[model samples]
Target: MFGIRPSQKVLLLWSTPVDAEELQAMVGELKSVVGAEGKVAVENVEMLADSSHAGSHFDLILAGVLPPFQFENSLNVLGEALRILKPGGSLIVRTTDSATTQSTLKLTGFTSVSQPEDASLTDEQKRDIISPVSEITCLKPNFEVGSSMKLSFAKAPAKPSANTWNINLTDDDVDLEDPDDLLTEEDLIRPDPTTLKVCGTTGKRKACKNCSCGLKEELDAEDEKRVEENKKNFKSSCGNCYLGDAFRCASCPYMGMPAFKPGEKVKLAESTLQDTS
Candidate 1:
């Protein structure tokens, strides 16, 4: 009843225990159909239900080989069968319960699940095998499990044309006013230096002791200029200013001043002016 060809691998699966002679006979028949080049494996349905076989191994799977073959765990058996069978492989199930078997086969992911009208068994063979045998055939899908392919009919979205954009603007929509016109009189006026704090410190113009804002340098320059102006106008009454401190009068204005050449200009060190006493 199996349309097994030569050189095609086949599996004969039986759930119920059968006579050793009958089992051998079934194996012999399957072997003849497959021939020497082909392979035929006989296994109990429980073995496949509990565990799994190598996927896509068998070309055809003949389930429920004996008559009155009813699977208690139909889903597991058929699912395992589908897993083991190669893509586009055929499965023939000889079942007494056609409705349940068909439903289980479809649920197990087998495609084209249907019952054959003619089982092609002779009257004598039917009598011997017991009557009312229904054969259900199904095929594993052509594509393997988890396999994918893009559809040829599916079209990609068309790209939008550059002409579709509305970039042309009317004169009324455009603003021709100069950017400078946006500023007010106050914005154009310069900010006061006193109001602007140096280095963003708490008080205005209050620079850090070790100043980095150039404010310290500017003040130092002004002090140096004042000192230079004072020195230019000074006329030493004692006339001992060019000599060292020891030669000058104790009340001398240049008392702490260092000795220098007669014509050389002397710049006093800042520490000399401090009133330590």
Candidate 2:
């Protein structure tokens, strides 16, 4: 058990239904541990996955029996827990699968990760509870902003490029001719913009007004699923940009981006095509 000082804020997340009497009992226990002068507040919420509480405000976060098999839900809850926990804050999770729970917490950037050797509550007390439980504890690093935590997906390997030239020449053939002789005036001169087969709307040769470039169509069901999942996870977004957390807004600098720093506005006007190239 952490020597939780007086006046330290704590958040309690539980999936099980906790009655007022049970909540009061827990709150009273916390008060006893922290001393009478300490102020203890307990929120027996069903889930702690909301982004509204995405800040380092709580000194400790105590969770009970989160759904381990449902990785997305677990990840979301862990992320929010990490985000809201203050620097040096402790996150204690009670889970049946210690290995999975430990790995998940470590992957979520929880440092000094360990399962406490001792137990706060007795075996009988734990056994009496319906939920399968054991304790794993970790602390948030003091210096981390926690905003840069991103979901990374494996990239599909690139296909080899098509043959660029049709011409074939024998190595034995002798040619001392000037290389400039191969170039026509039209090849060197910049082509007229109107004459080029560029999309009027998108200004690209590949992408037509109807978007027949096959970019959208190229996306497989798995890609679509990943996109949909990302849409749900990164709903906060970088200012107005809806692209995933990997991409930075062009209006903001690398370090000064809206994602890393709060209250930073997306100063540039929203562009349909953020990629100018």
Candidate 3:
């Protein structure tokens, strides 16, 4: 799920054991994917191979990489290698057609890289490349590698059920009984557009680009408050700038500038919060 460049590093891991020749080929192409200028490292390990035992640092990590049946623990292994990856580095994993992982990776810090389009490939082939390998896009938030207990284990923590927490930071009907208790979309409803305070930040509010939970409502509330303060401070600065309700009436942090073109006004880019200072 990442673009390999001449300056990047690629790591390939094999679980359930692997042959030497296949390992060699993987190493070769991985190094040569972008003009044979990048570094390639190969390792063959068993279950939980990404632990300290694997003893390798990688940038772009590939795991559970066998074909046909593909890799079983690709998700787990890729996570293991991710510990060593640079902030902007990537991990391209291969798994069966039934893998599912949480978008938490994006929330915490991980970006999926898309493959470049090729005219020679058929539409079906393209679709296959983009399809999620597990449970038809079923995924869960990954906490940490090596520490993940199997689902069969009684000690394994239960994950969030689907829609139990809406990523959109919205509620249909909130119970006033428990202000601290987390509510679900079904629990809350929109009384009206204005009454709803259609904020972009708060509990579990995430945008399209980032899955940062609860940030939207919190940020929106803070910004709304701040915008009010700014308006009061510069109530008559209409000549310098025009800010109607900075939080509700204008472009949201999620809804960025119509054009990303930089300007001299020092406006925050899309998906960014204003400097409260």
Candidate 4:
């Protein structure tokens, strides 16, 4: 309000009903602060009706369309509102997702979202969500000191691999249409798929969190309930490597780190470097 130019009017479009008296007082306060006569208009809004009427060239459109618990257009709805805003103007939408900003830009057809992600957020709701800006840039204990340090990750990182990297066309390497042997996770020490098993709800519960094993899934079958119940103690690995998190791909960074084994962390200091002479 203090910074309002003599020429411009502030338009308030909100989904909730505003207190007219308070709004009038706020406008009055703004006018008094600015020492200029200006206009302020307030409108109540529902998203699906008259979405286009909200703004034509709004310098700023602050939006807060609560997301549906079921999949809905909350992200894209806000983005559409953002599209009507003037360049260098803003369409601020408060949301809980870490990817909200990127989603906002992408949905509105922007190539990139700004860094220090929290800067784009509204100051009021900023406290509640993951401020990727601050959290991503916070001081690190092992960082180089007495100098500025920066990190930029490529959108695509190279797929890490095991065994030898060969450009050569050998029999071992694929020579397509010639003698060749395809290297598989089988060549690596892949755990046996047969050794791994999963239990459905009909199966004796192995605690929840098992993926649907399409092979043995027969929860709908009336005759198989007993069989499934008996199989609940089942164990399984991601069939070979291409399907699930498995031991073979434990070394593959794409597969990610293995689950921490019990007691391994407690004994870490003793397991590492020995007291050498």
Instruction: Write down the lDDT that model 4 would get.
Output: 0.41
Per-residue alpha-carbon lDDT of model 4 for 177-211, expressed as tens digits?
63235565667677765444445564542434554
Candidate 2, residue 62: Cα displacement in angstroms equals 1.3
Give the TM-score (vs. native) of candidate 3.
Answer: 0.33
lDDT of 3 by residue, 1-277 (tens): 2356676667666765455675676577666674555677666645345345433345566654543214544445545555666545555544433314334234334555333222233344345455334211112224433455557645767888886965553466543567646788767875654344333554232343463545456666887898766643432223322332343233333233343222234354433555455
Candidate 1: tens digits of C-alpha lDDT, residues 217-242: 87778788887676556667767778
Q: What's the C-alpha lDDT at position 52 in model 1?
A: 56
Choose 1 or 2, whichever is better by lDDT: 1
Per-residue lDDT tens digits of candidate 2, residues 77-189?
A: 67777888888899877665677878888888889989634335655465665535567779999865634654578568986668655567786776677989989998899
Residue 121 error, candidate 3, Å:
11
TM match of model 4 to true structure: 0.29
Q: lDDT of each model, Cα atoms only?
A: 0.77, 0.62, 0.48, 0.41
Estimate the TM-score of every prediction.
0.55, 0.44, 0.33, 0.29
On a 0 to 100 scale, what is the lDDT of residue 136 in model 3? 14
Q: After superposition, how far is residue 215 of candidate 1 from its true place, in Å?
A: 68
The all-Cα superposition gives candidate 4 an RMSD in Å to the true structure of 29.0
Candidate 2 residues lying further than 4 Å off, grouped into runs, are 35-38, 65-73, 116-118, 123-132, 146-277
Candidate 1 global CA lDDT score: 0.77
